[model samples]
Target chain A: MKLSKLAMVTVAAAMVGGTPALADLVFPSLSYRTGPYAAGGIPFADGYADYFTLLNERDGGINGVEARVLECETGYNTQKGVECYESTKGEGSLLYQPLSTGITYQLIPKATADGIPVHSMGYGRTSAANGKIFSHVFNYPGTYWDAASIIVNHILDENGGDVKGKKIALVYHNSAYGKEPIRTLEELAKKHGYELTLIPVDHPGQEQKSQWLQIRRERPDYVLMWGWGVMNQVAIKEAANIRFPMENFIGVWWSASENDVLPAGEGANGYKAVTFHGVGSDFPVFDDIKKHVVDTGKAAGAGDQIGTVLYNRGLYAAMLAAEAARTAQALHNTKDLTPAQMRDGMEALKIDAARLEELGLPGFGPEINVSCENHGGPGLGAIQQWNASDGTWTLINDFGPADRAVIDPLIMEDSLAFAKENNIPERCN
Target chain B: MSPDFLNFIETVLNGLMTGVMYSLVALGFVLIFKASGIFNFAQGVMALFAALTLVGLQTGQVPFAHLINAVLGTDVHHWGPGLPTVLAILVTMLVMIALAFLIEKVVLKHLVNQEPIILFMATIGLAYFLEGTGDLMWGADVKALDVGLPSGGSFWWEDVTRNWAPAGSDYFGMYIDTLDVSAAIIAVVLVVALTLFSQYTATGRALRAVADDHQAALSVGISLRSIWVIVWSIAGFVALVAGIMWGAKSGVQFSLSLIALKALPVLILGGFTSIPGAIVGGLIIGVGEKLAEAYVGPLVGGAVENWFAYMVALAFLLFRPQGLYGEKIIERI
Candidate 1:
């Protein structure tokens, strides 16, 4: 009993001293390394971990304040993610990136109230991109709504600048993340005089013969996929079997990955997807990773996988977390910072080409500047196509702004209406 | 007189195809139950495993040569130089037979006299084990299993005009998926093959006698252990066929086990011991629940289609306690 009491006292002492002694920013990573979604989740999580490790090792940490990442496996469940958030939120958490849309939705209110920021890059309630209703929630780069608009624009561009009377089918996973894009597509259909059909595939998405059989019967002009995990590969293969032109099919960012395409081989060729980030080993950031991290043996498992698509996404997320920390430290004028201070830092953070080059990524992508009223400022995305012969994804187009003259007012109006209904205060811009 | 009616009819037709797919899975559940008293809850996982194995073999994930070396102790990976689809299937059937033998010896043999429910729970454990094993062996990616089935459809006058019918007509014209139609035909063939083997073969007769009275069959010089092995082997084959149809339809993934769950309602609706009843029960439940969901789902929420099948079967149980074709029970005090 005396020993137990001593242990408890020691732990308490460690907690008190550890915060300032570490002198590093903490970003709690709620990962799902084991689940039905693990196949997709593992790569993303690995990338996230390695990038932070790289920063600490190669670049001497973010502004000399070492970045510390604590990974807690949540298995992609909302309840577990919430538990992870609560447990870790106390230990100087800079921000929370739940990855799961359901958990993101649940945390938005709590995080907003607590003054903690939630960075749901590319996957969350697309509506939460509305800075007025969802002040603390930041879904940057682009939302699902923006993705849908860009995809529609790409389709029309491919079909000679008209989509009137064309039929498009959305084969999506039956989840909040998958369904988020439907509102945008429905609105676009009404505006452009096209027909939209939605077909929802149940979770884990292994069985789609029936869904595709419906596709075969209906014979839509194009198919838009909003699937994740195993569903993406299945959809591609099914489309191939039914002789649907791969070029006519477009997948959201999550649906296009090496894991999704490699399993299908030749069958997945010519399948184009709207990608937000460029993928390949050509970037200078990847070169530094190979030399400083992988070669020096400081890298994690699969070090050879330095520049895969999901790996780069992970790097981007880590970069964002580190940048937020740097901003927080600078703003607060102290290395030892709180979650609230870190959130403010995130809002004030700006990542430009100079910062990217300093980190060894020469012009990796665009500069992002976050503000009070603008979460996803100047939303831009690229397009990539799968090349089965070379076994790689090739960039087909550079980042183009989503036809915002069409999407902006719609986003603003809907955001205002949502804020009024939910009793959320507008951002102090 | 509204587009809502047209949409409802279209949904019903879609539901019927879904029901047909569920019935194919149910057919496998019925097959095992007819021969053995144990309800095989792992049948859906068995289908998933089989389909994943097939895709794995074709994609060189599980090299044919490696399988041949493991089983037959021969280097035959390059043998026959890319076997035709038909030959690959035949080879897979042989592999399934070996797998059945292994399963009967390793798993079913240990729990021979356990209660049916206990055996059912064992199969559920087996289901989880197999799903994990299959995913680990074949890298948890979705693979399209195109078993050369046609996927085209045609619209008849009834199909075209059924949406124009009165609100309460309950008539949604048939628009069958060619895949479903083919699956139904294959299921019938499987049932007939199983029936002929059980009725005419000597081993089959011995198995049936064991099913009737275990002690009497033992006295009459029949081997219960061998009979159990044979029964399990047949069930495994049935699971493979079910897997091919299902895998071809959806893509082979671990989620195929949920499709196996649909068989429970089929078992409840049909007598657990009756083969014909299992098939008919599957069809009735499939068509009835799907029709209900299509016609009735929008009134509540859209997810009524998920639970409506089980609900209809539950209601049926209240009226007919022994199930639709269960044997009449005569209890003696």
Candidate 2:
């Protein structure tokens, strides 16, 4: 009942997964390129399509097989996302990047049943980091909780390692996506003895006058935002309107897109956000994409979006998926991979700094290894500051590691609760 | 005044300003519902389409950039130098008028005397069609609509109110977005214009006659088709002004349509058929939600603004279902 991905998902899903042999490695992009969230979706989808297109053009595809990328627009609606997943699961599907937490939640069960893998990536089911419970689902690099913990760690570092009396306000999106960090933030707030204010802005957060007014009244020491789409722009403007220190605000990665900042114009300067990968269009991997994909006029989206934050994240996600498919190919020693083979390949995945350097994505990621026991890799992150003078983002700090001590317990607790309720047996570590 | 009292006054002011925005959209709803007895669910989408058209025109962006590029294999995002804001608005108005005629000719004419629910459903379909058309024409990317309207908080207002802070208290001066103040003025002017148009003009009289009794008005030499077209055109104008204001405030995007949802509680509270009801209902909901969110919301962990309006409208319905200014429902069975 969430949304209709329509008749397309079934037809696509029917084609690839149910078959034994397929020429190309097929993956479905549960994209929302036309909605309130299209600003975020368009860039990510473009990056995704481009990076894979680069693979086909530059490297002749992953492991000598041209990757077949199909996109079904979800409008960020879960039903549509599920439709995309179900429809494309049959097209010799390797994996899914639902890109939405809600859709990932729905697909986790179905993907397990179908033996196809679901990669929620950075945005969904933080607890799916528990590979034992979510065998076919992967949320690697980091989870929202990992993100929340990194922000907290950064705050602790910012405060000269003491935050006993400071007040922190979390202005969040009021959905599952926004609520992801609340539990972890509360835990950190108690541990650090910092006062915490939780303010939830309803979706499409255009009107946040009252919320900013409250912040003005309370005057918290720091404010963290978990906003997306129009919410990010509105919140930034409101914060500036109320004279809230832009430097003090740290947004979730979703809030760190150019569309978010560009709408507010100069007011977006000095604002900061956490990112799992590097921001800016300066990555060398993008050169290969330009030379092979955009320059060749084969890019799936606007060539201008080649190096934006969300675009890079999309590129990064696609790279991971391609690598996973290659991993599966190498393990099975077969050019044609079944969904089960793809899952095994994804589980054995490893990407280090050297590998990243080899791939022209130096410093774009940290060492990442997914195992049967832990789907999430060493969840690494970095803080980036928006420099409006030049309209570019500068990474202000080296990539910080997500605090597993804080996140691991929550992941274990949630995944165990999920397993017990669903009668799922734990996988051997 | 104490800091607490100053904050309360400012919150109240914010609520009233927000009420003006809600009222603007609700006014469009009232005009159509009063004239045709059809609750136009497509009103919000109309506003969204209007805003997208304005931005598209303002930037000299080529319409159907995606489709044209796909079909012709040519990349052209803009045509030439952008139009003046005034010129773009004028062109957008003509487009809206054409849209009104198209809607009447294509959809509304066939359902001349249908049940209100069926008409409502038809408007919903119209909403979907217009929404898709808007995206297809404008491209789905978020567009910043800047016609050079002043935004951000009013420093003069803040400075003027600075003395109202209570002694030895944490008090920041009142903050208000200038756009909201302009919107308030525009809303008032719009109401005044509509009031005059409806009261004195010959076309206005015919419009009222149709609302009073469709068959009687038709018999008295007024063409129903013309009236329907005129009313829809007026609604389109209202939608255009609303679209410009909102698009200027927060870049033109898909979320522009959801503002129509806010107008609903205003409609229910003010009575669907009453023009003044749209304003009064918007104010009540706006002020009530703000107060509740500021005071009662904290008790419930905040975010009561989303539902408090509907709750108020629901309660109002129990006492007076016709709405605050709507005509009394009469039964003759």
Compared with the real two-chain complex, what DockQ does model 1 have? 0.18
lDDT of 2 by residue, A122-226 (tens): 888889899989899888888889888888888899889899999999999988889999999998888889999999998778778789989988999999999
lDDT of 1 at A420: 87
The top-ranked prediction according to TM-score is 2
Location of the lowest summed lDDT over 10 successive residues in candidate 2 chain A: A1-10
Fnat per candidate: 0.13, 0.51
C-alpha lDDT of all candidate models, in order: 0.73, 0.87
User: For candidate 1, lDDT tens digit of each residue in B1-333?
Assistant: 454555455545555555556656766666566556777878887777777777666655544343344456443433233445565566666766776677778888888888888888888888778777775566554565666776534345346666576767654443445666677677778778877887999987887787777789989999777777677667767777777876665566555555667677777787776767777777777666555544554355333444666787788789986678876678999
Q: Which lDDT value does model 1 have at B167?
A: 62
Which stretches in model 2 have alpha-carbon errors above 4 Å? Answer: A1-22
Query: What docking grade does candidate 1 earn?
Result: incorrect
**For all the candidates, what are their Cα RMSDs to the real structure?**
7.3, 6.1
Q: Which ten residues in a row have the lowest lDDT in candidate 2 chain B?
A: B163-172
**RMSD in angstroms, candidate 2?**
6.1
